[model samples]
Target chain A: MVFQSWSYVGFLLITILVVRLTSASWRWLPLLLASLFFYSLTHWGAFVILLFSIFYTYFTAIRVSGSAHMSIRYRWLLLSIIGQVLILGVFKYLGFFNGVMQGVYALLHKGDWNDWPLLVLPLGISFFTFQSMGYVFDVYYKIRKPEMHLGKYALFVSFFPQIQSGPIGRSKEMMPQWTSISLPSFEQYRWAIQLFVWGLLKKFVVADRLGNYVDEAYDTVGSMGTWVWLFILVLYTVQLYADFSAYSDMAIASARMLGIHIPENFAFPYKANNITDFWRRWHLSLSGWLRDYIYTPLLFSKKKWKKWAVVYAIGITFVICGIWHGASMTFVWFGVVQAMILICEMFTKDRRLVWAEQWGRTYQWASVVLTFWVISFCFILFRADDMYQVAGVLADMGQWNSSLLTTYLAEKNISRLMGILFLLTMFLWGDERWDRWIKQPQMSMNKSVLAISLMLTVLMVLGVFGKNDFIYFQF
Target chain B: MSNEELTARVYGVFRKVFKNEGISVHRETTAKDIAGWDSITHLDIISGMEEEFDVEITGFEVMNMSNVGDLYDLLTQKLAE
Candidate 1:
């Protein structure tokens, strides 16, 4: 069930009630059943594949942890990674690979070959595989102990709140909480509700509204002027952040209600001064996973290369990051561009710090603005469906006309647009402060009530209650 | 070298790698406690320590070293060897 729906709300309430009523030791049983039931709602195929992943990784990790010989452990780790990657590759990339083969066949003048049937991508397969693989890595590295309990390990992978989209939880943080499941205190409930309401406002009011404009612009890409395309690019970047971060907030809130803390995914990424900083803040769980599991090992293995080792690692890691999002060349290019930017930032770190000190706050502000624009432009590649669309959008940037901007502005809902702009400004201004306030151990009841009530009122009055599934759901 | 002397030498490597003169690390100090000691600078610190102490640190050793104390322990073991 989608997190925003009334059915999900009811499901969550029932699940929480069940958990609250269950004895401490038996709590995980009901929670695991609920999570599986929740996931089964998507597709039985997805359900079966998820089970395969859980079982495979569970056994592999145990094998890795059980082995005494370092070579045996290393071999098991490779086997586990291959299993996860093969699952991801066949399900996610088969179509893209098939299409590539078709192109090659056409080039060779080969007559129509039989097409292979594509399997439905299990929802959150990308997330869970990475998470499970990370668990295996942790076991191999001895960063944390291997979880021997099959039921608890499955719950860690399929926990309903974060199963679809995640802050991508770690076992060390989540496993203990599951074993010690307890009902959230009243303050915790209040905080979860507040976070949920804020996420709703971000999704329905801000993201969906901006999405309307972005979708419209993409729908008529050929006719849009350069200025309009640029505006739409910026809007898409904001919409993505709002949409994805909204899902993360809701997920974290849902998990928090069960007293399971997931990682924070986004940290005001737009305020970042460079691409490297942006990655650190945006999708923090995934980036942290990559840094710790992928980039660090790769760099250290080639540490003899010194600085070039970092460059090599960054390039490979981000290319994988791009492919991790989907099976498209545009996604690959998106990763390549980010890797390029980060490499530049790495090489210029000392110089940039010197510049920051020389120019102080002005340099910081300018860097933030510049980074936002760079991210916005790069997101054009991300937002487009394929390379052709990316080319069209980039080509459109060459045709500049001011009158088209006025026409574009005139055609849209000006009042709604103004409202979105105002809300966006207020959100940017108060986001960190609001986050800090809600996270405090003790908040004044009166202030909490007032804040939540105001947010609910805004959401009800302004939210576009259309069937806009979260953008990241596609990934 | 004594543990104190080794820790002092490691702290010196951290300071030089991060370019911060006032930096000090203790047993409990971690990457979170330092501003620039991320995955990237982490390698720099490792390399600097290797140079300063004339020892080789394996990737496994680096991964296991979660804090300054861990590093100090690894260094002492390496130096003794």
Candidate 2:
């Protein structure tokens, strides 16, 4: 269940009560069971896939790390990675590959190819498998010890809050927490509740409302004017950020309430002035994981490539990242665009810095706006159904008119849309103020209560409490 | 090599690679301690250390090194080996 649902609310409350009532030593049992229960709510078969992966990685890691023979350890490591990738491939990318093969056969004038029903992609398969692969690598490299306890490792793999959409936990970061359970502190409870409520506000009031316009605009059959496409594009970008970051905040806050600290996923990515900096601030855990596991190793693999190694590594890593998003050509092109821009940024760093120094704050703000628009342009590919839709949207760029304005104004919920925009502005302003003020002193209880009550009121009235499937869940 | 020699060589490497002469690394000095000391420059530093010391640094060693002190200790140990 999504964090916004009443079912999740009930589950979380019960979980908190159970954990608080239990002894510290036995706390993990309930938590683990609860996690499995939550995960299996999607499909019992998905639970089985998760279990097999957990056991496979746990055993493989222990063997890889504990092996006496160097060659044998290397073999185990390779096998584990291959197995995990194969599993992800079978479940997620089989349809894409099948379609490619069929197209190839048609082009070659071969006989008609038989179509097979694609396998159902288990929820969180991509996330958990990637996480497990990272763990096996960590163990093989001796960066972290393989967990001896199977149960703890299982918990690390299937932690319910982060299972659906993740800040993708590393074994080194999360294994120790699962090794032992601790009662939630009062401070933890208070912080988690506040963050959870804030996440709900972002998701329901801001993201979902923006998503309504985005979905409507994107689902239109024909092309739109340039202004309409760009407006809807910006709305999708904002909606995605709000939705994904909202999921992260709730996941982290939920984990925090259980005395586990998951990593923060976003850090004001729109503020980034360049593609390189944008990746650093967006989905930080996945970026860091890829840097450590994929990019760095590729960069360091060959001495002859020298300076060009980083360029090659970045291209490869981002390509993999795009494919990891989905089995779609649009996603592939999205990764290619990002990598190309980053490589350009790398090459022009000296000139860019010189320009920055010459132009000062105006240049910096200009760069930020430019980066946002460029990213929003790329996000059209991300939001499209296929390449045809992408072309349709791009082909209609010339028809600039006031129809978009007239049409949006004609919608019945125009006032609600305006209200959302106002709330968004207030949220952004208040967040900046709070960031600066939070370090000075804690808020008084009365002020805190009044602020939270106001937030709750807004949540009750303005919140779009509709179907709350998080956007990232599709990946 | 003596620790003094190693430190001087490392200091030179940092200065040349990062192009910042003001950087000074000690036991507690980490990536956070020095401006422009990111993963890209981190690779340069690793290459520099390996070339200057005439010693290979393994991936394991690279991953485990937390600060200048750890690097120093690792270099000393690798050199002894």
Candidate 3:
């Protein structure tokens, strides 16, 4: 069940009540059972995958840590990582490879290759796998000790709130808290409810609504003008940010109410002035994971290559990042485009800085806008159906038709569009404005009542109850 | 080398890599304590230290060094060996 659904809300309320009422010794029982129940909601078969990941990584990590010989530890680490990657490959990309092979056979004039029936992707496979594998890496590297308790480690892997869409908690940060379950404080509850309210509003009022427009545009991109395509790209970018960050916000808020703290995922990414800065701000958990686990090792592997090593590492890391998203060539191309832009930014860093100094803040603002547009275009690669659609959109960039807007206005009220823009601006630039306003120490009873009333009003008006799956669930 | 001597050489490497000769480091100094000591600059510093001290540092070892003090200890131990 998705977080935005009433069923999940009811489930969470009951779970919170149980946690609050239960003793510390038996607290993991309820949460673990709740998490397993949540996973069972996805597919009964998926639990097998999650169990394999948790047990395999858990056992190997302990073995890696206990081994005195570097060779033995390294072997365990390699085995664990490779095994996790293979599982991810089988579930996430096997069908993708089969399709590519079929195309190859067709090109070679061979008869059709009978493809096996595809397996359904288990929910949160990417997230839980990455998190568990990170723990194994940490243990092998001696960065932290592995948790010996199976239940706690399993909770770390299958934490219900973040299981579907994650801020991707690390074992070191999460395990200690999982071992010690406590009732949330009054202040924690207050903050959690506030964050939940805001996240719900963003997802319901902004992201889902924009999703409608994005869907309309993407479905008809062939007939849509350049202006329509541009609008769709911008809307899709905002929709993605809103949708994914809303999931993270809700996940983090839910965890916090249970006295758990997950990391923040996004930080005003559209405000980033360069591709490098953008990566730092966008999907921060994944980016940080890639930096630490992939980029660092690859960059350091061949120091003789010097700065070239950074470039190569970045390219490879982003390609992996792309593949981690899905098993599509478009995703791979998205990574390639991002890597190329970043490399260009790197090569031109000195020149750009000099230009910035000469031209001042305006140049920097232009860079920010340029970066946003570049990202939006790359996201087209991410969101488009195939390479043909990508080529069609790019080739038709110059074609403009004013009728698209006129027709939109004829169909929908301009005031509603203005309202959406205002909401999007607040959601983007003033993301935490409501939270900050609510957390004021001098908050009066009347103000609190008014805020609650406003929240209820928004929920009743804009919240879509069904089809509430978050965008990142496909990963 | 003594701890003090090893720390001095480490300081030289940090100064050159971070490009700030005046920047001071101590036992508790971490990435946040210094400017431009982010992930990318971190590799440059690691490479600089390796070149300066002629010690082979693995990625695992680098990951384990929480602060300058750990690096100093590792370097001194490696140098003594």
Top model number, DockQ? 1
DockQ of each: 0.67, 0.48, 0.64
TM-score of chain B of 1: 0.92
Can you tell me the CAPRI class of model 1? medium
lDDT of each: 0.87, 0.82, 0.84
Candidate with the greatest TM-score versus the true structure? 1
- Write the residue-wise lDDT of candidate 2 on A68-109 in tens digits: 888999999999999899999888898888888888889999
> What ranking emerges by lDDT with the best candidate at the front?
1, 3, 2
- Candidate 2 global lDDT: 0.82
TM-score of each: 0.97, 0.95, 0.95
Cα error of candidate 3 at position A437, Å: 4.5
- Candidate 1 lDDT, A1-475, residue by residue in tens: 8988999999989988888898878889888999999999999999999999999999999999998899999999999999999999888899888877888898999976566889998999888888899899989999888898999999999999988988788877788887778778999998898888788888998798788888888777777788888778778888899899899999989988877788889888989999989998999989999988889998998887899999999999999999898888899999999999999999999899999999999999999999999999999888998999988887877888788778767887677567767876776667788667666657778988998899888889888888558888877
Winning model by lDDT: 1
lDDT of 2 at A232: 78
Per-residue lDDT of A297-416 in model 3, one digit per residue for the tens?
A: 888786567778879988999999988998888889998888888888878877987898999989988999998898998998888778887887776566677886677666668887
After superposition, candidate 3 runs with Cα above 4 Å error: A403-405, A432-449
The i-RMS of every model, in angstroms, reads: 1.1, 1.9, 1.5
Specify the poorest-scoring 10-residue window by lDDT in model 2 chain A.
Answer: A432-441
